[model samples]
Target: MNEIGGWRLSKKLGSGGNGIVRLAQKGEQKGAMKILRYDSPKARNRFHDEVMSMRLCADIPGVLPVLESQVDPDEPGQKWFVMGLVKLLTDQLSDRSGLRTVVQAFAAYAETLAAMHQLKVSHRDIKPDNLFFYDGGWAVGDFGLATFQGKKAVTGGGRKIGPIYYLAPEMLNDPGNADERCADVFSLAKSLWVIATGQHYPLPGSYDLDHSAFRIGSYLSGERGVIELDRLIASATAFEPSRRPSMKLVGEELRAWLAPNVEISMPTNIDFKEHIAAIEQWQHSRARAAKSQKVRDEAIRSLTNRLSDYLNSPLSNLKNLIEKSLGITTTINKNPKCGFLELRVEVPADQDRLAFIILILDLNCESFPAVNLQGRIILEWRNKAGFINLIWKRCYEFIENGADEPIKIDTLRAEMTEATLKALSETLSLIIPSHKIEHKPKLVRIKVHDEKGDMLSGVSLRFIDSEGITLAAAKTANGIVEVALPTLKNVVIFVAHGSFNSTVVTLPDENLLVVLNGDPRSRSMICGGSWVSLAGLKGELAFVHDEIEGGIHRLYVHLKELSGNSGAPGAVDLSIGKPVRLKDNAGRVAYMTPRAVIGDNYLIDFEHAGDL
Candidate 1:
């Protein structure tokens, strides 16, 4: 057994040219103890700088946190430091966790590295062993060769620091002129390559070791793995530092790959149970006083035909007016209870497509009694290069008649036609040359999953603008959907699969992973089957039945969080069912059952089925 300072070394972790690491223990706390091997001034200074760098990034979530440091009192020159001990990446790989876990771990690692770069420090060594699973997530360690931006080099020129397999070409060819941050990016990309493909390095004859160009495109272009991860690694490992994306961009890309769901909370003043009860009462009253089925069917058919004729005839004139004025071509299509118009505008000189205008008008007679008219107008445009772009969009709701006044379809149609023309004219004026715009199209990747973390294929994702206009829609291919929009404007994403309560997500600028509740095997099964109001709680608890595994039906209990000065609920003692628990990346307790108590274990009994 070896001992350094007050830490007792149990086993040798690893050794390198600069120092040796050992599993160290002090009282009950365990950590990694690194002992410097060289007594030279350069080596001593490098060790001191490493400690300083760690201290600088101590607050960052995923960067390894330093515990203690000291100079060997007896030797007067030797130095050592202790850091939080964590499981090796090899341990995770050995356990054979899913590919999603691997991607999530690397994504956290990238975010931590990017945070360090934001502080102007670069970790020159980013390889597999240096990354460890700490607090249930990945963290970066080993800053021995770390460099600070705008600071003089600590080591002499011509001495490359990282291993050859992971070294950036510039580090070998022109060490003096190489950008330390870019070199770190290159090394991280290589690390990701290893994680993605389980290979030591790029394929043996992929590219010359001396050449700066990286020829791992073939590996990156593979059909397996996440597409966004492939693109990010490719860009990070570009031949030139200028060509590589910034660490911030790398962090964003990684986060997009691990895409978490967009969180939605009920409004503060809304009581879900009370709202549902009110709606039920109103429905009962309406059902008691409704007309005969035959009479209702006849009325519905008449209204449908009237709406179809109005859109075909009156709306056509409005479409022609827009085309003649804007010098574009238009198409009209009928929707279930609405009408859709698409107008395409082209540049006169080049004949290249310039813009697209879409309009959706609600034609349901049922809604006319409450709100006379509702519609939306959207404008999408692209540069000379044909890409999807959005220039302007707006939703309109107008009441042409109050309870005292009867509704008139002709009057409503004429008024909407004028409003449509005005909106189109205003939109075209704001369409500037694409080259002059500063913001690029934002890429949004959506992955749909079930409660058990299994990906759902063929799910439909619809992108709706702020004004409730459907901009674009796509079905998931292999549980993933990727779309590019011209702007990072606020939008809502509506996800639908056979009858799983359609989930609505307010789209963020970043990518997303949407977890929905329905089981495809049973189309009639309602998500969160039914809500049971808790005795002393402000909100209800509902159980969503998941798949049956190992002869046990797994159910997720969702607890809606309380609002305002509502007191916290008591420990929910469910004697009827067994409770399940989950963990987050940091090993902190997280509840799969929404709004449940954190850090507390659960016990549930389901002996008496169908009884709350």
Candidate 2:
């Protein structure tokens, strides 16, 4: 079609069963437009349903806004709807190890679902594909299956409609009689399971009508990775509908489950077999080239001179290859109990290039693990390329090479350690630092003290500038000391004691006071859990988002501990205009106030709710 209504069709981005989504621009309005297939009545009806559904959810935080829509005049039987486009969040369940993105996205989705349920709406088709990640929250689509309380559904003669993977057992069997709310809950939990495991579904077959719940649960529960999520979803997808929890309860449980655990390893699609083959091929080509090449004395001298330049640079030895090899070695028969070890050696800064051997003696005889020697050694080096690059080298060879004698532990250990240390140091010297921009600091002040209220004496503090410069010096001031910090944007401050290190942040105009009040060994708080202990805070508090876990939520907390309001957590419903008092832990009334929007989210601001 050349044009629809007044807008010109740009290009097709994606398509579905009902319509093809196209990027469209009309006058000053720009958005993604979905056009229904002209021949299918079902598709047009589905498009209308989605338009109305998203329009109703526009007020919700995560749902996207439906800008406009109308029937296509050029093409009879076709309808078109325009809405804001959002970035698609693909299958990344494995990559999200720390659960930061997943948790934040899920929280917004949960809030949107809760808001929908409260408005007497049911999103029947709840699947990962239907969930569109947007700025504020997820935008749910495909509402052809949506059904209101007194209205007839568009599917199965107002019967049952939902993705088979997420459909509740009761919904499939009872259809009209089953509560749509519970079905949404089951779907949400099932969706979370997919996000956790990166699996296509609970089991491997087409939508089999005669599926057994026990079989499905057994399969899902036994899946590898994200064991916690697997078990939670397994429980939610129980055959007995009565056994399943409510959607709100499921959301709460999921939130709690994700709080403590952080996943580290994510799934990678890199082909290891192909990579190995390429490495082997490269080695063959390089060996052949080296054997056939005619080298001149000048070329040799140039290479040696470059190596000399690297050795004489003022960077870490670990970053240089030549300097690192000269200083460190890998030892086999070494002190096993040593938490850390250091060796001092001399290196000739004028050497052209020297190859150092590093040997790793694996104590655990069960398996041979590849040692990551990337940053283990440092060398001093300088480069003119405006950045530092690590001069790194490693070789995989048998401990005894081709020797026919069994190696002694002590001898092999000494040799390996010697070689490894030297090689690492040389590598360090070759490294080139990344490009950076340095800014002059303004000024900030930081304070620190010990539990006895005594000033901690002789503490070592390191200041990191925004341009990646780090300066460290011992605290000359006794227990009480003040450090004048340059006012640099996005700089970090690190504080360290005996074996423990803490990061305290310095914000412009905000005074930084750290008072160590409890036993260092205690993980649990000595006071109530009103505030997270300030000791373990690692510069994370400086940039807290509005929707973080510790945000101002309308929960049943003892407001009496706060000061003005003294009442049970559940005594009054905490809302926008609700009058409530807070009491501190010592039974003193805290500030009484109505809620207000602080940033993007709403929180209770302190004031007398009304005239005292």
Candidate 1: which pairs clash? 576-605, 576-606, 577-604, 577-605, 577-606, 578-604
Give the clash count for model 1: 6
| TM-score of each model, paired residue for residue | 0.41, 0.37
lDDT of 1 at 56: 86
How far out, in Å, is residue 70 in model 1?
1.7
lDDT on C-alpha atoms for all candidate structures: 0.55, 0.44
RMSD, every candidate, angstroms? 29.4, 23.2
The alpha-carbon root-mean-square deviation between model 2 and the true structure, to one decimal in Å, is 23.2
Off by over 4 Å in 1: 71-77, 149-153, 204-225, 260-612
Among all candidates shown, the one with the greatest lDDT: 1
Q: How would you encode candidate 2's per-residue C-alpha lDDT over 99-163 as one tens digit per residue? A: 44664556566667777876667887888887876654456655656765433225653445688
Worst 10 residues of 2 by lDDT: 365-374
